[model samples]
Target: MWFSALSALWLAATAWAAVDRGEDGNIRSIALRTHTLKQPYLDSDMSSRWYDFGGDTVIRTDSYIRLSSDRPSQNGWLFSRVPLTATNWEIEVEFKISGKNQLYGDGFAMWLTKERGQLGPVFGHTNNFEGLGIFVDTYKNNRPGTVFPYVMAMVGDGKTPYNKDNDGKETEFAGCSARGIRNANIPTKLRLTYFQDKSLKLELQYKTEDEWLLCFETNEPPTIPSVTYLGFSAETGELSDNHDIISIDAKNLYTTAGSSTPSKKTPGRGGASKLAKQKEGGSWTWFFFKIIFFILAIGGGYVGWTAYRTNQKRSHRF
Candidate 1:
């Protein structure tokens, strides 16, 4: 069994060693509809059950969810109502951005944040966010040695603000310049994958239909919020573009070999901290159980001794 497990790991590593930093072909995953949105997005009452929309967001049942159209000072958002409880997960977002003008400013963002459905300067969401933000920037703010329509990730700590002038140059942890990402023939899509304390990777599917090009991967994932919410937000200033989200496929990735603990969290709880608390609680339970067993054992021993004494007395009487 050990040998088989080692071989499986070796094969997965070898697959990742390929030219493209695509997903490990052997990895197992299941789609999570709680974090997914597609065509005919809204329910019968013209409201989405799993997601919430805000700002100037417009929902078209037959087509896409238009976050913002080709107009100036536009802001729109789509945020999941529930928190993502999976320990490890992947989110694939299909979207399109296009405009008649040669110039376009602002862009969109994919988020796993503690603060959702809030509006601000950071791509229709708030600054000083409490989780992960992957910005698909269409305009070049002031990034040197990089081009526009870039993809960058930032992990916010709820205190530091996003530098709109510097285009998040201050707090960005991982990023890549995705040229021609604003308007792609195959429709631009990005896949963000995160494994707790392991790795966080982003891939783009703009070049071809099925080919996913790697944007970046970091071995040490940033500190994610204990209870994260899925969200997408977009904003446009003077330069405008039509930003639309066609479909979204969210999945919870896990390995079959080991049991994947769901990251169930309350307001004051966290993942690792909660696990530690559970362990501590279990130890106390066992400690009490052992004491009870010891007491029961002594009680049985005393009862047996008393019966033996009574038997001896009865025998003498006989």
Candidate 2:
């Protein structure tokens, strides 16, 4: 009986060790197909890869994708169709936030998660969600002396609620408050890197010097499940900003199966895996709206030109 018990314990330890470390003492490296989000409406192919939610969100000027409007109580979300199937990967994003004036409330969140479009009080997506969330909070929800425009990260286990009242201090795994993330001369950049061995690192380019500031690194196992979605969400209470996502680059850092870790294979035939297939709605309305918006914009430009010409002629006569 003692021998049997000892064998069981040994088996459990071996399993834990396997899950806790990378293959061959290091995570395998891989190359992933890049998905770029820019201009002329999200392509139908990209529509197949990305999901947009909320009324105020839109793609504008054939390039920038606006995630939210500068309106109170408004919220918006965009999720990638691709799932981070591999254990080790990196996602980099270039984004900008601007508004007519200074006041901005709530903030924006970038997520690598098991949940999609689940809206709630925390940054437009649900709290207690499974996976990791990196938030660029633009408003100060805490006391008078606290910093504004904070960047923070939280890892969830699908059961713990984020402490929204205290600005996530209670639930934050790691974070930093960056003052100039919004309205910068150059777009703000963030990179998230995760390894199978459980090191999660974040780098930020909040200034124009082209340097990456290390926010924080943690050794905790990314409690998120194997299959997860990549998404962004934003919310506004009394204040708001025009949150624009310029680009997103997701790269798989580990090699496909047949390496030392043959058990963990890339999803599907490609290095990137599609978000678990979900029913998508028609895009005719979106198509028509884009057409009308462009038409009106052109007409408005013509009218302004004609008016300016008339004024110039009158001035010459005088």
Highest TM-score: give the candidate number.
1
For model 2 the local lDDT of residue 261 reads 24
Q: Which residues of candidate 2, in runs, are more than 4 Å off? A: 1-31, 34-36, 44-55, 143-146, 255-318
RMSD of 2: 25.2
Could you give candidate 2's per-residue lDDT for residues 141-209 as a string of tens digits?
A: 663566778888888988899887788877878888788888888768998888776578888997865
Give per-residue CA lDDT, model 1, range 17-135, as digits (tens).
44231234234677898999999999999999999999999888998998888999999999999999888888889999888899996899999999989999999999989999999
What clash pairs does model 1 have? none
lDDT of each: 0.84, 0.72
For every candidate, C-alpha RMSD to the true structure in Å:
15.4, 25.2
User: What is the overall TM-score of model 2 with all chains considered together?
Assistant: 0.67
| Clash totals, every prediction | 0, 10
Residue 226 of candidate 1: its Cα lDDT?
A: 71
Off by over 4 Å in 1: 1-26, 258-318
